[model samples]
Target: MSGQAVLGVEKARFLYGANRVFDSVSLQLDAARTALVGENGAGKSTLLKCLLGELELDEGQIIKSRGLKIGYVPQDVPPGLGDKTVREVLESALPHTDGGEDWKVDVLLDEIGVSYETAQQTFGSLSGGWQRLMLIAAAAKLAQPDLLILDEPTNHLDLSNINTLEGWLADDDRLPMLIVSHDREFLERTTTRTIFLRSDGAHSFGVPFSRAREQLLHRDAADAVRRQLEGKEIERLEKVAARYRVWGVKNDAFHKRAKATEKRIDRIETERTESYVARERRLELHDGEIDAKVALRVQGHTVTIPDGSRKLFTIDRLNVAAGDRIAILGVNGAGKSMLLNALARAYDPDQEHYDGQAAVRFNPQARLVYFDQKMAELPLRTSLLDYLVAVDGATTKDANALLAKAGFPYHRIKGPIADLS
Candidate 1:
């Protein structure tokens, strides 16, 4: 709330060829941790890239205080760091100094309550939540950046890990941060300022996420009402101008009044307030229906690590009927993903791979689709249109129609999926 401006962008505009991601966008960051929120594909990630100089704006420029340092944590762990030890990964953030700064890593880890034994393991061996937390710790503690930028920091984190992150971010040191996250509760807990990135521009507020969102909605409503009033005034002026023109046929003096009224109408139209109403997009799900009461059955299943190193948990019996919605809950290493993977692998539409003694079974008519939370299955380089067309039974026309329905512009269909926000 009371801090110097560390970084900013003024009247920024970025375009992917003909597709504009955001226009006239501008915001400044200070000492308070700020939440940068918007709907998916609204260029939140793109804006961070622009701020970090990873991407160039088509128009406008980035502003940073001289000698400013920035620490950035992406949504995903960067590639090739999986095999490195956690200590090595944290050490990478440090500048070369006399002797070394490796001791700082242990101190930071101890402060965060991560065990020393875990530090020696490969970075990828840790749980997804811990990996993200370690990266953030390295950035905040080791890098000593003037401003820290985090993109989706709560992603893949369990409730406990999320609380840990909230505490770390809300520390009394008051490090400057620009956090892009969809987690409203997390933002409200950790951030003091909020910036809403919309297509028209960025709106900054000196309040937490919920309060900032309320202010934004109120502003939009006020603009809408003002526009309506302006429209009515323009209509009234037009009618008066038309009447004046008719009267001018009888008196020359009325022609000047008609011209004056027409000019006022034009002025009102020119200065009219423009409000943004985001386009509607639907994430359509498959409407496939199984013609059976029981869609899946599981019995005597021992869930374990993928390599069968050790058992995680055991399930005696479970049945999922058609229209039944179930949630699997667990902490970080509780085999929730492993159980899901086992069930997804066990689904056999042909019903030829299983005997009556199978641990998992699905109805003959049951169809299955597994969505990996990391989205590793998707080919990032593939165009959206091509990816959609590659689907079973999907024609090119059908793919285009689906993309349109999902609110993707035609120009974006040819762009790689990685380019999507």
Candidate 2:
């Protein structure tokens, strides 16, 4: 796993509009399997796009060894249509056509639990899970490319398919793979290195995801301590300045020394002050009594498709009591989202039919407050105090306290979020 094809960047810079995503960022990726982990808008995808040569860096160069073939499975796959079947999709990854080697396709499909009859079926007709499985098999069937890149590859896959992919990824003979996945278990099983992209930029760690997380937390703690020490030094300098001012009124010798001391204090103040970094916030459920009384009740709910000929889904009955912290779990297009929308409507009946749910105070998943790794939604143009006032309706004092709780320095409350990022 050592001294393999080096994929790296030097002084990399990326910009989107006026926003600078990465400034002087750099990292190295070697032969070991690596996992890219970050929150929604943390530029993980952007980094991958750079690696795939889909997007060029604004101010740096990415160098890969010569003749490196990269196989990429994007986050979104093209609609499974046209003339391609499951077998054909897998075969297309190969350099030359081997139409006669039907057994190879059969073995792969069977290993992934897809029957030969199923392979003959049109890709368009299959469910999302099956299509995802087919794509995984296709990627695996490719002759060892120099690097394999899979972005959110587990999205629509089932447990079995994920396990199969995991086993393939864990193989020693397989080429180095860069996987962007939120599945902690998958990262633990396959990746030997973890690269975390933050608002600051990309950082590579030698350890796996779990260990990398621990290392990051420890680093933040140390940083906090360093900032605190700097703050104390500032306070001590301020005290010396005050003492000098008092002495300057009484003695001529003291007055000259006080002026020099005041100048030194001013210089100290001008030095860049260390600001505390905010850590990730975790949700804490309130400990309160929940009555058995149902907060929401849905019965015989069904959504008609746009064509008016097909029913997307039908749920016979569902109930949710007050204080129930429930997660609606299902694959994409599985009607879990539709069911939530329907429930919101049922709870709020004052609005029009078009306004699905108006009565219940349902926070849409997209609208729920999230402090992602990139802090994209943060008010970059305004100060931290202003941003807090805008988002949480907090006054200056309350906002400062909140920032402190989130590990921000007192002086940084007036600093612009853009500067922090």
Candidate 3:
């Protein structure tokens, strides 16, 4: 810890129209590394925008140290940012464009372990995890940022890359960072400071995330104890008030005492601490028996690029049983997505057929629902309820119920689909 604040927000309040997203929020980014975490739509990203000076505080102010350069890696790569080589992407990220052997660029790439060969590959061609690493490398090196802000940096990262990032954070790079990620292990490994954003306010825990969570458990326990005590006190006061009113109905002394006790009860009722609610979500698999034993089959299937000259893979047999679970693992350019896409296209209701695959068959009883890793098919601009409703003409009320069952809070049902994280 430097014991000096790199960034500060004092008495800050942010609003969207009439809704106050953050109220009287005051915090300091002092440590070399910090984490900003909250449930979906708790204004974590908004606060990050406040820190980066992208969004102005509607009430208070943001204080930044002089000569501070902030680097930001958003949740997703910018739209239309495909087909460019990694080197070109890094070059574009730099303050000044130059040659491959640029001293500063090389130094930053070395810091992230992005070699010249990997740098030559198309940025868009890299796997999701590699792309995440590349983006981090670009943000860390290109801006030469004193403060780096990453939004869900571990979203697509594999185990190896997540470990790599953890190691990168553990090193004494001396770069102050405020990363917004829900990866608990990653946060425990990387950030020393955890700022938990709640709906009412933000709680800053000056410890690792796991320790912070333990402290939160303690606090919640303490709050429960205090609440129980308060409840008993209120009950006692109410009993006293009732006895006094009944014993001396016409006396001013008894009336005064009862009224005072009632006032005290009101205060206690209004000032109660918010109870902690534990959240648990799980997917319940159905026990229905499929009509067919073989849920899917692909015989002599080979996926190739559009050029038809490059062979991705040749599968002699791919038979998925009704209850079978399969995992596809491959390095970059290894056709994991291609294989899935081919299978999904094979089962498309539109009856679309690809030129490469010899045979693609699905059981008549089996229905395929492919969830893309990017979720690109989802409507980003729509609200969650609206998106679900529009998907199948379901009522908004029904959609809201579905989302609630899926663990979305009632307050968050109206939030934009793209901003779920």
Candidate 4:
């Protein structure tokens, strides 16, 4: 990887009203693929938007190489492209190029081992993972960008798709990239540089994610120690100055000494080491115990496609007890989704009221909470505080407290959820 800085931000500062997202953030991306990492709502997305020219910075500038062309793959598949064939979607990226460039789509699919049938299929007809992969292929191969930016590319992917993405990235080593992801293993395998975005600024390291994170945390610890020592020194100085003041009431020399001591204390205060105080944020799960030992049971259930024209798989018997962890594994296009979807569909809150036997049965005392991978249930326009307040038994004060604990600034609580990174 080249050491030359290809893209960078210098002293960048951005804010939402009085809420500061990041201040004095600066970093450079060279030929080495870089990972942009931070806590949720840490302004990583906002910073990327600033770099992509979608959002303007309040201070500083984004520097790029002359004629730099960037290809960006967002977290979600772009709207209105679901009706377009995979080949057509790739061709759309080359609108300004000559007609001869259409051949790149075929070459890209072949390079990634995609079949002709997949190329002819509509973008929306494919799984979420495939849809995202197609967009990436189009941006990288068809657009011919100088740099590629991928945001959470593995959000809805299965293990097979994730491996495919990793392989593609490994093969495309010539292209510089700025990837924003939370997948530690993916970053460790794909990126050579790591950048940590914080409320005060950004920290950059040449090492991969794990090593870079270790170095950053170490530096924070050292700063904390230094601050503690500085505090003790200041305390000692203050005490000496106080004693000198008491003696100076009777002597001019002591009065001069007291003034010098006070000056020393002021200098230490001015140059004292400052450590970062992280926001009170936590990621936790509801720890409620089920009243029944056996939470669910399944027997003779045949999982099928949405239209029920074809059967994917069948379960002779399956049991899930309370406090049990389960994992369903399969390749892409297999019956993993079919099985999960079938189970989710069978779960009804009123199942306890019905006495009829069924293929799937749940204990009456067991409660179910399903998390959709697509995050379709999240309301885009509602503010974080308002969303929490809407929850049963959650008061406005409680919501605000929870938001604070989740590292959201008080000023940003009223901002729409869509604005979150």
Candidate 5:
């Protein structure tokens, strides 16, 4: 954070089509591990692209030092890579029309703490955690660039993979990095500085993420107190001036003094200290009113997934009341997954529909939304506004209002759903 900056952005501005993303933004980046953090649709990705030279500034300048090599870790791998092995995946990272060297693969695999023997497995066959680690390692090893950029690296990683990434980031000081992540602990452990993108502008803090947030909150609270005290003083001065004005009708000298008091009140009001208030973007969720007395009920509810070997689950009785919160817990190979599938099918235990061997009942008006442990299949090409309009319970105007409630601004709703943060 102390050395001369290798990159400088001066009065930077960028626009997506006609919507202005950044206005007169300015910042400096030296050889430091910096974290880029902000709410969704706050232009963090756009700024990163500008830094990487992938996007051009609309009305400002970016000064970069000579021969500034940048390595970018991709947010996602291409779908066709599922059939490739780990070694093949790493080798493909090179510009190979005919052939490429294999030693680079071993070196990067070792650097990322993966054994060479493990490279024989198909890249897609590994757990999501290991896939992300290997993908990052491959991208990093393609070229030992001076600056490495990672965006949301923890997206598919598990706890163990996340710990591995933490070690990799903290492994050296020589590597300058710009990391964009929602993982607060990862930013705290890796980044030396943080840049926050807000509606007002991009603000840089020479401290860890959590510490910077704490400072912002504390400063805002103090400003609130000062504003409250100043409010009372302003009110008192106005009342005194009003009383003097009433007396001025009877005496001439009182009128002159009343003018002075009015001037004093105007000075205080005009020259008052401006307050600094921090804004937060959040979505509030509420469980609306459920009129049904009995939302769902089950009697002798049992489930089993058979591989022609053993029974997976057998429940004696299960009951759910109105507004009941339920959680299913089990280890690998347990029937937790099967239970959910059974609910979706509305199946009974004895290979029959509802009321076969087990009695299952549900209110006809009840609706459910399920989030499986897989990426949602969204219409990536469709605009967010269009997608929301397609969904039930809201008109186009109502959809936009709901998006506002969820902290998304009006201009961004017309963009593609996949482009949304």
Candidate 6:
């Protein structure tokens, strides 16, 4: 296969109202796998939309061969019709005819660990993780698109399912792919290149995420040193100028030398000062010994839906001790949320069973603030101060400080949180 399956972007520009999301951003995307990464609001999604022709560029051009088949797996699945089943969704992608190749769908479902009986069940009843898995299988199996774009494909998958997806991506002959994922390991394992979008625009590097991270860190360090040197030079110029002003009043010879030194200092200081690059805030939780006083423990926990007589999930054993900051690992329907609820006794216990010693003062996952992938659930209607009051108690000064740290402006604090998005 030729690398030119996907061509380069020549000075592309994308604008939303007055805000220019991409300004003369250029990149070359070949047939090799690539990863797109950026912080929230960096326009990563917008760029993908523009590439797919869903959004037209305000300036420049994206040239590609006609009839370029592209498959896009969105971060969130749209609500499906209740009448559709898991198998139906997959089969729908195939051309309807008697004696057609239905085996492709079957093979994919099996490979992705979806059972035949489960396939027959209604899609609406399936867990979110399972739906994500089915969608991935469908995209991979049905279209075999020349280019596959997956956004957060591993969001709901458990470790096992994630590994399965990783293996699929790793297959040497797999089609060219652009994955938008937060899973550092997944990007490292699958992509040969990375496209990072910043507030200013987008840039591409021919390296994996881990290597790219190292390069970025090294560049930042170099930039910091340059800035420090520039600052020192500026200080030196200020001191020389002060000495010149003081000495010029008394002695002619000394004044002339001081003036010459000041001129030289000014010329040196004329060089541009490098801008300081802001670093991403990384949250690091302290790791402490797990206390014997268990907050939650489950053994042989399983969830079975009444429809299709299929076993939805089966967990052998799970445990959570005090001060354990454990992340639940599973795909959408893998029953992670359900297990959490069951462990917390939020819902009926009959849905799942557990046998183990458990004690907990609080549900860390539930209580310790949540930043959902979709920011829609956040308290958008309330004022920043009001929202903080609800979460951390009513302290206006403390709320203002925390909101500022989170990037909320003083002027915007009083505005509805909905306006922030």
Which candidate has the highest TM-score of all? 1
Descending-TM-score candidate ranking: 1, 4, 3, 6, 5, 2
Whose TM-score is higher: candidate 2's or candidate 4's? Answer: 4
TM of each candidate vs. truth: 0.92, 0.66, 0.86, 0.90, 0.69, 0.72
Q: What is the lDDT of residue 112 in candidate 6?
A: 74
Q: What is residue 136's positional error in candidate 6, in angstroms?
A: 2.1
* Cand. 2 Cα-lDDT: 0.68
What digit string (tens of lDDT, one per residue) describes model 5 on residues 161-265? Answer: 677778766766777888899999889998999888765567788898999888766766887788788788889878887888899999978888889988987
> lDDT of candidate 4?
0.83
Ranking by lDDT: 1, 4, 3, 5, 6, 2
Q: Residue by residue across 159-204, what tens digits does model 4's lDDT show?
A: 8778888888887798899999999999999999999998768988
Candidate 1 weakest lDDT stretch, 10 residues: 1-10
Per-residue lDDT of 10-107 in model 6, one digit per residue for the tens? Answer: 78887656665657677767687989987755567777777888888899888776667777888777666446988888886664545387898888
Model 3: per-residue Cα lDDT over 1-421, one tens digit each: 2334488798889987666677878888864588888876678888888888889989998888887777889887876567888777777777665564467667766866778887787777676777878778777756567778899998777666777777766665578889899888888888889988876577799898999988988998998888899989999999999998886677889888888889999999999777766554444566336877888878888988545677998998888989887888665456777788888877854445533344888775676767877887788888888877887589877777778777776766797877566
Model 5 regions more than 4 Å off? 1-5, 78-80, 93-101, 107-118, 125-127, 219-366, 371-376
The list of candidate 2 runs beyond 4 A from truth reads 1-3, 79-83, 98-103, 241-276, 279-421
Candidate 5 clashing pairs, residues 3+ apart or interchain: none
Position 163, candidate 3: lDDT: 75
RMSD of each: 2.6, 8.2, 3.5, 2.8, 6.7, 6.2
lDDT of 5: 0.73
- Stretches off by above 4 angstroms in model 4 are 1-5, 95-98, 335-338, 352-355, 395-414
* lDDT, residue 14, candidate 4: 92
The lDDT per prediction is 0.86, 0.68, 0.78, 0.83, 0.73, 0.70
lDDT of 1 by residue, 42-154 (tens): 89999999999999999998988887888999998999999999888998998665437878878888887778787898998776778888888888778877788999998
